[model samples]
Target: MAWIILLIVGFVGGTVGSIAGLGGGIVIVPSLLFLETSLGVISNMGPQIIVGTSYLVLIATGLSSTIAYMKQKKVDFNSGFIFFIGSGPGAIVGALINRFFETDQFAGVFGLLMIGISLLMFFTKSIKPIGIIKTGKLHTYTDENGMSWEYKYSTILAIIICFFIGILSGLFGIGGGSLLVPIMLLLFGFPTAVAIPTSMFIVFLSGITGSVTHVSLGNVHWLYALALIPGAWFGARFGAYLNRKLNEKVVVTIFRLILIIIGFRMVINAIIG
Candidate 1:
């Protein structure tokens, strides 16, 4: 019964996450805690273990979504690669450091981060393409649906931003997409379509790195993570499909609302627990 609930949570998380480019952690982490508190299954599980398990689940979610996005030719491989260069190592460091915080301390920090992201998303305007494509520095591409996009950004700047995003991902087990998507859109000038898929790809790499570290530390609960994978896999593909059909503004607005709600919940949980 508890496993069933987790599977359902995974499906919902994967669907919303793929569409919003926020990854499954936003739903998976909190839902897991809710289940544990309500069902009393895994009552001994600590927050670190929960976070580690979330990273494992994210590995599956990211892979499924990336494959779907690749089929649509929506992924920006070059940009993903650049972001991974910094995020990959940062994830390892974050995972290693995660054990240092108490459960409530981690929750407080995660809550604060989510709130910051929510506010940023709420106030930010839609991003437009820069419209200039340099041969080596900037590039233009068309998606499978025939929409074209062009973008230009500083590689150093993106790397620095992604490194911090990876640390937060590793620390909180949120897959870093919540931060990455907005930064790519508002700061680096990526289109919503491009940012969604590219962020997933980067999350895939960073998630794997963080998961490995957690595994080495024996922080992962394999049975729980395995249960989440099947639902997350199918849900991610469906969500990616929806991403093509929905209005970008609508998607972002919904994403922001989710962040605000989840952030508030986390803060309250930390305060009361």
Candidate 2:
């Protein structure tokens, strides 16, 4: 039953994640925490284990989505790679910091972070690209359908934001796409179409780094993670397909609601426990 639940959760997570460019970790982590609490699966260690497992699931989901996005030529490899450079080291630092928190403490922090992310997602409005800085080398990308986009941003700002996102990713076992996508859209003025795939690519890199760190810390449960793999892979493909079809505003609205609900639940649980 537990295995079955994990599989189902993984599929749902992957699907919504890919479509919203939020990554599976946002869904997987909270769902796993709720499941464990309800089922009495692991007692005191449940939250930590759930976080670890979410990262593992994220690795698979991120890779699958990134591939799909790549095939569509929707990903900006240059910008994504630049973000990845900062994320890698930041993930390691976050993992190291995670070692100091107790399970409840971790849950509290994760929940609060989720709430903050939800608020950011909810309040942000779409804006046209403006005040383009012409100093840096312009990065241009052409999608599979011959659509082109060009943009430039401060390298230092990109690094700072990506590094912070990576820390949250590693600490909470999120893939960082939830935060990254929004940052790209709001801060860097990236188009929705461009931000989703580019964020997925960055998430893939950070997921790998965070997953490795969690594995080294003995936080990941291999059996649970293994159960999630197949479902996440197929679901991610389906979600990426839907990304082309669905309305971005609708997707983001749903994403924000889910985050708020889960975030509140986790925070309450932490306080009560």
Candidate 3:
């Protein structure tokens, strides 16, 4: 029964995460905790195991979405790789940091993070992009309407920002795309079309590093990951398609509310525990 529930959680997490470019780990981590602590549907999953398992599932989610976006020529591999330069090493350090926290403490920190991300999503569009710098690596995107948009960024600044993003990813088992997409838009001046897919590419790379670190530390719950992987992969593909077809504002608004609710719940639970 728990495994069956995990399948659905994975599907929903993957679909929502991919469509939003946030990665499924946000939903996966909280859902796992809820199942373990609230419902007792699963047993013996500590914060470390939950985080490790979530990152493992994110590998599938990120890969599927990235592939789908790539087919549409939406992914910016050059930028993504550059961002990974700092993120990869940062992820290693974050995973190490994650090793110290037990359940209640981790829950409090993670809950606050989820709420912050929720607010970020809510205000995504209203937040204006940073003014064009015109002094760094310039990139352009041509929309279906034949409008051309160009953006630029300092490689050094991008790498520095991504390092902190990677720390959050590895520490929290989130895709960090929630953070990455905005930075790409606000700081790097990436067009939305390019930013979303590029964010997923970075997620995939970060997932690899985060997963490897967790596995080395024996933080993962193999059975939980097994239950989640297949659904997450296919759901991400479906989500990528939906992302191309639908207006994202509605989806993002609703998802932000959900994250807020879940975040507050986790925070309360941690306090009570």
Candidate 4:
């Protein structure tokens, strides 16, 4: 019965995360805690273990979504790789240092981060991307309306920003899309279609690096990962399908609302705990 619940959690997490490019840890981590602490469906769990388990689940979610998006030609492989170069190391560092912080202390900060992201997305309009170096690449996407959206970014700047995001990903199991997607959208002026799929590609790569650290630290619960994998894999594919059907503006609106709700929830949970 607990396994069944967890499978459902995975499905929901993957679906939402894939749609939003938020990496589903937002759902997976919280649900696992609810199961363990509230319902007693699982036992002997700690926050670290839950985080580790979440990253393990990300492997499946990221890989599945990356494949699906790639097939649709939605993924930006060059940009993804560039971002991963920085994020990879950052994730490892975050995992190694995660043990030092009082996990609850971060709840308020995380909450604020989410809230701020929502506000930024809500208030901002499309703008030209900054290029710290002339070597940055230009990416373009054509929407169903036959409108082609073009964006560019600096590789040096992106790498720097992504490294920090990777640390956050490692620390929070967030897959960094919550932060990366917005930057891609606003700072880099990437289209909704391009930003989300490319974000998933980065999530997949960083998940590998982050999971390695978690595994070495014995933070993962393999059984839980096993339960989450099938649901997450299939759900991600489904989410990718859904994404293709939605309007770009609609997707951004959904992203904003979700952030606000999640931010409020995180703040409340922190206060209660």
Give the per-residue Cα lDDT of candidate 3 at 1.
95
Give the 10-residue window scoring lowest on summed lDDT in candidate 2. Answer: 125-134
Order the candidates by TM-score, highest first — what do you get? Answer: 3, 2, 1, 4
lDDT of 3 by residue, 1-273 (tens): 999999998998888878878888888999998899889999888998999999999899999999999999989899899999988888888899998998999998999999998887666677877675557867888987898998888888889989999999889898788888877877667888888888888889999999999999998999989999988998899989999888888888888899899899889989999
Best first by lDDT, ranked: 3, 1, 4, 2
**Please, what are the lDDT tens digits per residue for candidate 4 over residues 156-237?**
8999999999998898777888788878876777877888898988888999999999999998988888888889999898
lDDT (tens digit, per residue) of candidate 2 on 126-152: 455454444666767676577777667
CA shift at 106, candidate 1, in angstroms?
2.0
lDDT of the structure predicted as candidate 2: 0.80
- Stretches > 4 Å off in candidate 1: 38-41, 126-136, 143-147
Q: Give me the runs in candidate 4 sitting further than 4 Å from their true place.
A: 106-109, 124-135, 247-255
Highest-TM-score candidate? 3
Best by lDDT: 3
Candidates 2 and 3, the one with greater TM-score: 3
* CA RMSD of all predictions: 2.5, 2.1, 1.1, 2.5
Global Cα lDDT for candidate 1: 0.82
Which whole-number lDDT from 0 to 100 does residue 105 have in model 1? Answer: 77
> Model 1, range 217-266, lDDT digits (tens) per residue?
99888888888888888888888988888886787777778778878887
| Model 4 quality (TM-score) | 0.89
Q: Against the true structure, candidate 4 has what lDDT? A: 0.81
Please estimate how well model 3 matches the true structure, expressed as its whole-model Cα lDDT. 0.88
